[model samples]
Target: AQPRRWPLEKHEYKRYGRQLIMPEVGLHGQLRLKNARVLIVGVGGLGCPAAAYLAGAGVGTLGLMDGDTVEESNLHRQIAHSTARVDMNKTQSAMEYLQSLNPHVNYNRHEFHLTPQKAIQIFEQYDLVLDCTDHPTSRYLISDACILTGKTLVSASALKTEGQLIVLNNPPRPPGDALGGPCYRCIFPKPPPAESVLSCGEGGILGPVVGVMGVLQALEAIKVLTARAQRPANGGDWSTNGATSEAAPKATLLMFSTYNTPQFRSVRLRSRRADCAACSAQSTISRQSLTSGSLDYVAFCGATAPINLL
Candidate 1:
């Protein structure tokens, strides 16, 4: 629950030996991961692979958030769930797998859907957040919470054979900071038409498609945490996760398609919008509005509510 006060165990040095050798994740970087608290807000396709890698990498605190239960249908793409785990709370199922992967890492099980009232409180406990949920409503809610909590966000989604990824709220500066990266609302002020929204259950995703996106989410998270390992020397603060120095890096959106001229395309993103309601200077969103549930994310986004099986 706190930055690791002790040192990595002797086993950890060997466990993370491969990454420890890399300049990107040297001894100090490995320590950053051990002291990191990461939250994954969905234990489905994307969250599964993302959590696996983070656990394997020895992230100290791994928070699994989901209200759904595992089912036979999820076995195809939800790699962490086993046949025996069917009908188990998703967060519980993931915790079992992740804990097994690395018993040294701590695990938190949040067996509830992320609502506006709980978003900020939950996000405040973690240093970084992964938006692995499938719906636009959840995406918007997650982003807003991350922005409000000043936590960096690694968000991704997959449908059918395609997946998209974007990192938001980097350097997680307070609203109005020109150097801060954009939030979900800045890039997508309006959600897609309700009729256009479709779940993987309806659209059909290939097993590997979503998994790829999830793995990429873990990679970005490591980059963010490990980058912070070098921050103390540069005077970067904790709010930014010390992912970068004085200024936030240019934001970008990565698109991956199973069938395309190029499998990967990187699209540069503009800085936080001056009027973004979530992460910009002229914003109207606040902790009060979020906690009071004044805004209806599902209605606003016109997306299907996730099935609540918990």
Candidate 2:
């Protein structure tokens, strides 16, 4: 006789026991997590902690994208890459740690900077994306790619004790869909002047500021992944009663600061902008423009001259 099969391996029940027992992430939710694919771009301060939590939660597949190698300076905030792993590609270093955390998760290492040409093809492979990068050009590229491929984006950034979080292109609605949530461009129609852009290395980033944002990114991702409409009561398909739905989540800009009296605040965002360049009905951005090098995002953002003496 054929051997009996189980929905989850026996060890998995014990491994994800805590979350597996919660209504928010019961058996069904755990299964969703196990089947989902998430890509994290820029495995630095924000990506490190976010990847750790998601890996522990059993996200089936994780794609880590980064071109930079580990540096001693990264130790202060990039938690996954260790001192021993210094000089290694960021994705490889992070994957080594994540594998130890959860042997069950499948990891892909994209060891290259994200470019407009490469964004769509890579974005298509994953269910969702985390924009852990700290620059605006890459932010626009990520958002546009997520919109084109119909994938939600959980993007966050931290610099000099301040951090902000936003989920863009949620529900993965296609271009011209009025019901679609806003893309990054809809909120900030223009990138900040290139001269004004500052990297964490240049301006400095507080360790916990980014750590908090990254953890929140993982939390939001879990919410999005496990969110299921309540099934008919007659079926009783869910393993437990805790998995229930609420009204769809609103798109809000979450701002954080450790020094502020009120450390957390949210600004509600408009749904979709009809005139938005990326996701709107009259969008000027298209797959062709993105892939053809005609878009010229770097030029759009401008390249600042090196200041020999600031």
Candidate 3:
């Protein structure tokens, strides 16, 4: 006789007994977390902590994508890597650490930059995307890909002593809804003049600051995936219940300054411009038309412009 098929066992609730006790995240929430899949696009300062926490929290599957290798300088902030993995790929190092944290959680790693062609293909496989990249170009590219694919994007950014986090679900617009909330492009219609901005290499960052921001990023991802109850009437166009009524869903821009006096402030995002180069057909179509030739995003991001040399 053939051996009897064994019944699938339920998740080890005892392992997450404390989380189960929380009113916000009880048994049901834990189950939801176990079923969710999240994609983190970078394994640097921000991604390291966010990915660590999410994996520890029992996210069903964690996807880590990064093309860089660990460096001696990165050890100060990127807590996921160690001196032993100094020259290893960021994704591999992150995966090894996450696996050790929670062996039950499924971990996937991609040692490649998030190119346009790879964005849609990879994003389609996951339920949510986390923009943990440091550069503005990668953030915008991920945002555009999320919009086109209709995926929830939990976007965050950290530099120096501050950071910002936002959830963009691409809520459905009502018929003839002319007042659309900003996309990433609405806030930054174009990449800033390359010379105007400095990288983390030029401007130093605090290790702990990135840690706090990354934790918040992971928290937001959990809230979004578990469908947590929202706070009452914050007076924002975006619905607290994650619903899109007649009003356009708002985009929030938060700033943090940690050098002199630590502070967090929310900046109002302007309405979307119909003529935005990134959103407008004039810009996207022209770029998409270059199928026969290669497109250099670094140049498109203005990083390779003449002014960037200065």
Cα lDDT of model 1 by residue, 40-141, tens digit: 999999999999999999999999999999999999999999999999999998888887888998999999989998999999999999999988888888
Can you write out model 2's per-residue Cα lDDT over 1-310, one digit (the tens) per residue?
9675878889999999999987767899999999999999989999999999999999999999999899999999999999999999999999999999998999999999998888888988999999998778788888888988999999999999899999887766899987677889988898899879988989998999999999999998988888777544444345566565443334799999889979999988877787999998899999888888688777677757532110
TM-score on alpha carbons, each prediction = 0.90, 0.91, 0.81
State, as a TM-score between 0 and 1, how close model 1 is to the true structure.
Answer: 0.90
How far residue 15's Cα lies from its native spot in candidate 1, in Å, is 0.9
Residue pairs in clash, model 3: none
Where's the lowest-lDDT run of ten residues in candidate 1? 229-238
Task: Choose 2 or 3, whichever is better by lDDT.
Answer: 2
Q: Score candidate 3 by TM-score against the native.
A: 0.81
Clashes of each: 0, 0, 0
Report the CA-based lDDT of candidate 3 relative to the real structure.
Answer: 0.72
* Best first by TM-score, ranked: 2, 1, 3
